[model samples]
Target: MRIFVIDSDPSFQGATVNVTVLPYEPYWDETVEGNTTRYSGVNYNLLATLCQALNFTFRRIPTREWDEVAHLVEIRKSFMTTVIYGVLPERLQRWDFTFIFEHAGLYFAMPTPVIRPSWLSFYYPLGGYVWLAILVSTLAVCIALIQVMVNEDMEKVKNAMCTEQMQ
Candidate 1:
């Protein structure tokens, strides 16, 4: 909301704002081709938006280090900076930070889903009932085979005993 309360501060109007940055890639990065220094990234893009919102023009300091930016702000050579520095004691003595622009949190990237064509794929998605039925049927067949084998063995033993009695 309130980036800086420059409403009462006359030094803000049309101020040649010296912005120091850390060149955080995807946030701010300098791409130089011969004599031209072209800036791009999120912070670089934010520059135009911030200037328009505050009604002031800005120029970026060439330095990329955090300490150098702090020193520039300390000496009042720069109006402000574009770099996002952590709130540290040494830096605090030099410059005052405005409202927090961002809050860091856990970040994760998900992998792409695997694609495959198979007959089993259709059955795999079936609920527990299908698998349970398959398991129960297999078990029943196994028990029936065991019972048949035991009965056959018992009949062979009875026939051997009857032949022994006749002899």
Candidate 2:
């Protein structure tokens, strides 16, 4: 049997990078075991895997809130962060993102809307004065039509009386 040796890369030299961690459940969880702080979850696992594969180490940056985590990364207080931030357009402009390995779905729900009767749409746009105007106009037209019909009937009666006298 032959003996083999593996050598570490000189580029990384096991440099420690600063990483900010927030205890987001399912993605990140920070636990205290005895005196040492232990982190476990999907995000942390990914970070650990990257460090191991790249031959580099990372130091945890302490933060209290989600905003602080982003602030630390934004202000260069940390080299990176271990959390799943939504990839927004503004965020993409400021930072580089890795390929998406996981997805979380968001849904918006509201109470069912109250539906008014469809016929009510006709009156919705009109106010009290406008509706009164329409009613008056319609009645005026009907009265005018009745007057014209009555005048025509009187003219026929007069013509008949004149014809009978001529006979």
Candidate 3:
């Protein structure tokens, strides 16, 4: 019952609030009939306590998914609820989120090398096309240098110059 309201009407102390929630796992979910949300997880559990403290009746409007809620919030929906973990810059621009119900830390699985360590790994970052381009360009530079050397001999100068100019 501890909901936070930011209205400048001192006369309005006790009023009902409609909050749309994005169903997420145990935090909040609908019973098979989609009539009411069953709250058990830490986020919704805390929300229950907050609602009690704030002394306001809340109406629940469940959204399809988190992505859908994100889109709705982007379009500036009238009411917002659910477990918002972080205050990202983009989210801040559209809405005013004032609650931090939980904190999620980053966790990434360490990649194991499928192939044993070898010097060949140096090319793993480059795509096949890039390697092919490098090989062709190197070969082209070598051929041009050889042509320059052949042209210096005077005998093949006209042929090399013709090939170089293409005219």
lDDT of 2 at 102: 71
TM-scores vs. true structure, each candidate:
0.48, 0.55, 0.57
lDDT of each: 0.78, 0.86, 0.69
Off by over 4 Å in 3: 1-16, 25-37, 55-59, 64-77, 88-94, 101-110, 117-119, 155-167
Better structure of 2 and 3 per TM-score: 3
Distance from true location, Cα of 22 in model 1, Å = 2.1
TM-score-better candidate, 1 vs 3:
3
User: Clashing residue pairs in candidate 3, if any?
Assistant: 1-49, 1-50, 1-51, 1-52, 1-53, 1-54, 2-50, 2-51, 2-54
**Model 2: number of backbone collisions:** 0
* Residue-wise C-alpha lDDT for candidate 3, range 1-167, written one tens digit per residue: 89998766433245566666766767775565467544556556666666776766666655777777666656655355766557889868866777765676777998886794677689887899999999999999999999988877876777789889995
lDDT by residue (86-142, candidate 1, tens digit) is 666886776677756766666799988667578868766778998899899999999
Compute the lDDT of residue 92 as modeled in candidate 1.
74
Give me the runs in candidate 2 sitting further than 4 Å from their true place.
1-11, 108-167
| Model 3 TM-score (2 dp) | 0.57
lDDT of 3 at 102: 65
Better candidate by lDDT, 1 or 2: 2
- Model 2: lowest-lDDT 10 consecutive positions: 4-13
**What are the per-residue Cα lDDT tens digits for candidate 2 across 1-167?**
99976665534568999999887888888789899988889998899898888878899888999888888998998989867777889989987888677775777999886676899877876899999999999999999999999999999999999999999
